[model samples]
Target chain A: MLMILDYIKEKAEFINQALAETMDQLEGVPPVLKESMKYSLLAGGKRIRPVLVLATVEALNGDEEKALPFACAIEMIHTYSLIHDDLPSMDNDDYRRGQLTNHKKFGESTAILAGDALLTEAFGLMAAGAKNAHLPLDVALTIIEEGARCAGSRGMIAGQIYDLQSENKKISLAQLEQIHRLKTGDLIAFSVRTGAHIAGASQRTLQALTEFAYGLGLAFQIQDDILDVIGDQEKLGKPVGSDQEKNKATYPALLGLDEAKRKLSVCIEEAKGKIREHDEIRPARLLEIADYLLSRDW
Target chain B: MLMILDYIKEKAEFINQALAETMDQLEGVPPVLKESMKYSLLAGGKRIRPVLVLATVEALNGDEEKALPFACAIEMIHTYSLIHDDLPSMDNDDYRRGQLTNHKKFGESTAILAGDALLTEAFGLMAAGAKNAHLPLDVALTIIEEGARCAGSRGMIAGQIYDLQSENKKISLAQLEQIHRLKTGDLIAFSVRTGAHIAGASQRTLQALTEFAYGLGLAFQIQDDILDVIGDQEKLGKPVGSDQEKNKATYPALLGLDEAKRKLSVCIEEAKGKIREHDEIRPARLLEIADYLLSRDW
Candidate 1:
């Protein structure tokens, strides 16, 4: 357990440093824009997505150095989505990760531009990083295509729109699952797939990882729903019951708490089973990460 | 003039068709999201940016078909910027291109997502297009990097932040020029550069086109400011004097109308001179395009 924790800490530190250096070295950008973007970017999330990228690469015995930029780029996309979702017109979030939301800290317009700039710069970083890392162009292009698809209209954005529309409405469990799968699941899946692809994993490995990712994503979301109902505010970094206040459809809200927990256990086990079946790849860290999510309070 | 008009019309039609086809062929995206994106994307603009791309490629005798996706992607970025700019929290415009603005027609949240989706999908289209066209990975990566840089924090977004800041304030001529150059000029310059780079032009050709694009971009903005002051509302699509209403510092507002016209003329001359100096490349059409900008009302 200590080893897994140390591994996560080391990888997180590496990613955080790369992210900061990338921002510090960026030139020609306006100071205000940089500040606004950096505020949310470095706001100290758990760095789960980027860690997954590095972990997957490591699990496949790939060079983690070459995958660093893609990891950072995914983090940027994640940060940008959070910024936009916190906007007054969208979620109207007053606080995120225990700090004032982007629009609350910066003005709304600047927040919007900050989000735009982060999303745009993510692509630039990927392309430039691929060039620098000497990653094959075809592989780089495919990864970028997958990144855009996961983050765009057909994936995360679609989930966001659905989530917004579902606000104050009583949506079914299946619909809730669909929304979570698209809104957050696709990007999470993409992160794992990207790491594997970069490592030159075989088709069998990719397929197993894909299944593992899908289950892990759903389990992650279920735990999030459960946390909203029972999480400590200091630990969770936001007010509890916000989902209930918004009347948003979530697993614990739709399913009974016990049933939701059961479902989460099922997902975590299924996800672990996929990883365990691929023992030749030694993805023990991924299984540990999945278990951590299952038990995480924040 | 007739030849130039015909050239613009032919190229615009080609671009419009390609843009429409791309939208139609996009799979798995939500219908409402697609509708919202398509509304703004297909709105009748002059298609100036994409046309420059095709025109530059034609001048260099490059494969226009191979450059088609890139041209379309730039247009997507342009459309996304417009959608975000017209948001209620931003410009608060009720109309664009003589139609209801994206947020006004589609609602704010969807409009925001639509903008995000379009911007993200543009990168995907570029990567996929490069793969399909068998464009060298390095070239494709460079082009994508340039596209992101031009449209990101250091370029278009920077200009937007500056423009927003300068609202209702007196800005200097140089300051106004800087804003426009970053906001509109970088992307336009990128359009020409991408076309030329795709054609594998010489370093000298690239440098000349870079200068030409800078001059042309500034001239285009100056003409736009001139039109805002003295042009007809019917031809211009939106109302006139909106800049004055907002107290925005435009070229004509900073430099008097006559001086702005003089600046425009100088820009046109300088831009045309660069192309004409490289007459061995037979860039007469580019020269005509510059002249057309010098006289265009919309």
Candidate 2:
């Protein structure tokens, strides 16, 4: 456990350094725009999505160097989504991850541009990664296209649209699942599969990783719902009951709390089963990441 | 004259068809979301950016089919920016291209998502273009990165930030130029340069196109400002004097109308000079495009 923790820490430091370098290239950008972008980007988080990218690459014995930019790019997309979601016009949150939200710290205008910059830059980073790696044009372009699709209308944006429409409305469990699966699930699945794509994993192994990550993403969202109800505010760094206050649908809100927990546990185990069935290769890092996901309170 | 007009009409039709085909793929995207996206994307406009891309490719005798997706992608980016700019929190414009603006047509939340989806899908279309063209990976990646940079923090978004900040303020011509260069110029410049990039134009030719497009873009903005004051709203579609209403520092506002017109004439001449000096290629289409820019009232 300690070794895996250390591994995550080491990979996280690499992502942090890469992200800083990425943010430093904002020549001629307004100081406020740059500052707002850096604030949210540098705000501390678990770096789960980037870590998943690196871990998947490692699990397939791919070079971390080749995957590092991609890992950072994934994190950028995640950060931008959070910034935009926290806007007054969106989720209307004042704080995120224990710091003032982008729109709160900077004015709403700057924060909005900051998010736009981050999202746009993520693509540049992705293309640069593929270019720097000397990947084939088709392969590099396919990877980029995949990232776009996973993050765009059919995936994350779709999820956000559904989530917004569902606000203050009573939605069925099946509908809730649909929202999470597209909104949160697609990007997580993309992170894992992108690493596998980088590593040139076989179809069988790629299929396994996709299945595992899909289950893991749903479980992660379920646990988040559960945490909102029972987790400590100090540890979580945000107010509890935001979902309830918004009357937003959540796994725990629709299902009973115990049932939600049970469902999360079952899903995690199922994800682990997918990993274990991958020709008994023993993907230690990925399984450990899943374990950590289930255990984290924040 | 007739040939150039015919060529422009032909390319514009191709772009329209391609855009329609692209929008038809939003199967699972929610109805309102899909409708909102289609509403802005399919809204009739001059299609100037896409036309430039197509024209540049034609000048270089490159494959228009290969550049079709990229041309559509530029238009998508243009449309998305308009949608976001017209949002209640942003420009608060209720109409664009003579139609109700996206937020006004569908609602703020869906408009935001629609803009995001349009932007994301544009990148996807670019990648798909590269893939379909079988362009070398490095070249394609470089082009993609360039587009991202031009449209991202250091370019279009930066311009937007500055524009928002400069609202209701007296600003110098230099400052106004910077805002327009970053906001409107970079992407227009990008539209020209990207086509050259696709055609693998010589570095010298690319440099000429960049310089030409830079001047042309500024001239285009000045014409827009002039039209805002003197042109009929019936022809321009949207209301006139929006810049004055917003206290925007336009070339005319900063330079006086006569001087702004002089600046526009000098710019058009300088842009034409760049085209003429382009290794004697006789880029007739580009010259006509510049001429059209100088004459267009809308």
Candidate 3:
């Protein structure tokens, strides 16, 4: 288990490096705009989504190299969302990942353009990846379309809209679940499913992986909500009780902290159970990820 | 000539309808956000880029249907840039294409998201187009990469950065040309070239088209600069002298109005000259476009 954890970490680092190199190509941009994108992108996170993509592909005995572009694309999409979410018109966050947000480092206009650049570049990278991998055109096309759906209105954007409108309003637990599933879960599902699709996994296997991702994603968001209410700011790298301060609805707000934690545990268990039918090689790394995410203090 | 013009108009209207239908598929976005995207996108414009794409494809004797998705994709990209440029953080303009800007109608946050959504959806549309056309993977990949380059840092975004930084500065005529060429010329070139490539045009044809587009694009920008300094606001649908008021550099500022107009004429002639080697079918429509662009009074 420890070895598997270390392996995932190494692969995550590799994906992060690839992401940096891909973003570094934007150096041709004016120094200010390029720096703005780099400031937020390189500020560093766990690179969990990219890792999930790499790990899932590896578990399916797929070429890790072939999956690298989609991994990078997913991270770019995630980064763009963070940048926009931190803007004054949105969440208005000044700090992200324990540093000044993109808008604070670069003016709002540059930040906005940087985010747009990242999102557009993600598609370019994905297309280049398809060429590099020699994948079937249909496969590459499917991945691009599905990835966009996950990131666009029916997915993350919709989740954000719901989040914004739900602010300061008391919403039901089902509505909260819908928001998180779309906002957070859909992308995670895409990360795993995209890898599986690239690897040409059996439809049955891909379906199970998706269910596993869905449960894990929900668990991840619930843990996040619990952390917001009770976690330490030092570890979380963000102010605690921010959700409460902003009257933002969360799993904890809907289910209470204890209930949220219990639900998270159940989600983790269910996610692991969904993948049990898979061979040891394919499910082991993802199961470990579910454990790590649900148990993390931050 | 009239028959071909009618065919082009019919295709353009079909492309417009396709674009509108595709945009209407943006489910789950907030009504306000959806309205914002639609408001700018549906606002009447010439649909020039997409029309150029279809025209190039037709001129190459390729199936126009195969190019439709790309046609819509370029327009989406163009619209997204306009939406972002009209934001308060950027140009701060309240009007575009004779209508209120996206930011004015939807607020800054929604406008930003609308742009993001449009850009993301463009990729989705391109992928779908690739699938529908049954083109080879490499061709589809190239189209996506070229489109991304036209929209990203070294292309439209870079142009915007320089435009912002050069505000209030006394830039040389050469510097102004570089800015507009990157901001506007690169994408227009990409629009023509992508269509040709998708149609499997010869290297010689692609090269000739690139030169033609560059000349035409430069002329287009010079005409815009000239219009801003002298045109009536009611006809232009926006206030004139906006560049002067904002201290933004323009061709007229560096080259005088008469010189700018003369330069535009030279550009139009050069653009037409490049395509003279091609069959009459290729140069005819493009030359007509150049003339129409330069002849516009507002």
Top candidate by DockQ = 1
Candidate 2: where are CA atoms >4 Å away? A280-282
Cα lDDT computed for each candidate against the true fold? 0.91, 0.86, 0.85
Better of 1 and 3 by lDDT: 1
Model 1 TM-score (2 dp): 0.98
Candidate 3 lDDT by residue in tens digits, B1-298: 5654565577678887988888777666667667777887778676778888877887778888888888888888899999999888889999888988888877887888888888888898899989988988888999898888888878999999899889888888888999998899988998898889888988889999889888988998998899999898888878899988998888888888898889999989999898877863366666676777778776
Rank order by TM-score, top first? 1, 2, 3
Q: Which residue pairs overlap in candidate 3's backbone?
A: none
Span of ten consecutive residues with least summed lDDT in model 3 chain A: A276-285
Interface RMSD of 3: 1.4
What does the lDDT come to for candidate 1? Answer: 0.91
- The DockQ scores of all candidates, in the order shown, are 0.90, 0.80, 0.74
Q: Could you tell me which 10 consecutive residues in candidate 2 chain A have the lowest summed lDDT?
A: A275-284
The C-alpha TM-scores of every prediction are 0.98, 0.98, 0.97
Q: Candidates ranked by lDDT, best first?
A: 1, 2, 3
Give a tens-digit lDDT track for model 1, residues B1-298. Answer: 4599998999999999999999988888888999999999998799999999988998899999999999999999999999999998888898789889999998999999999999999999999999999998889999999998999999999999999988988888889989999999999999999998888788899889988999999999999999999999888888899989988888888889999999899989998888886943568888889999898988
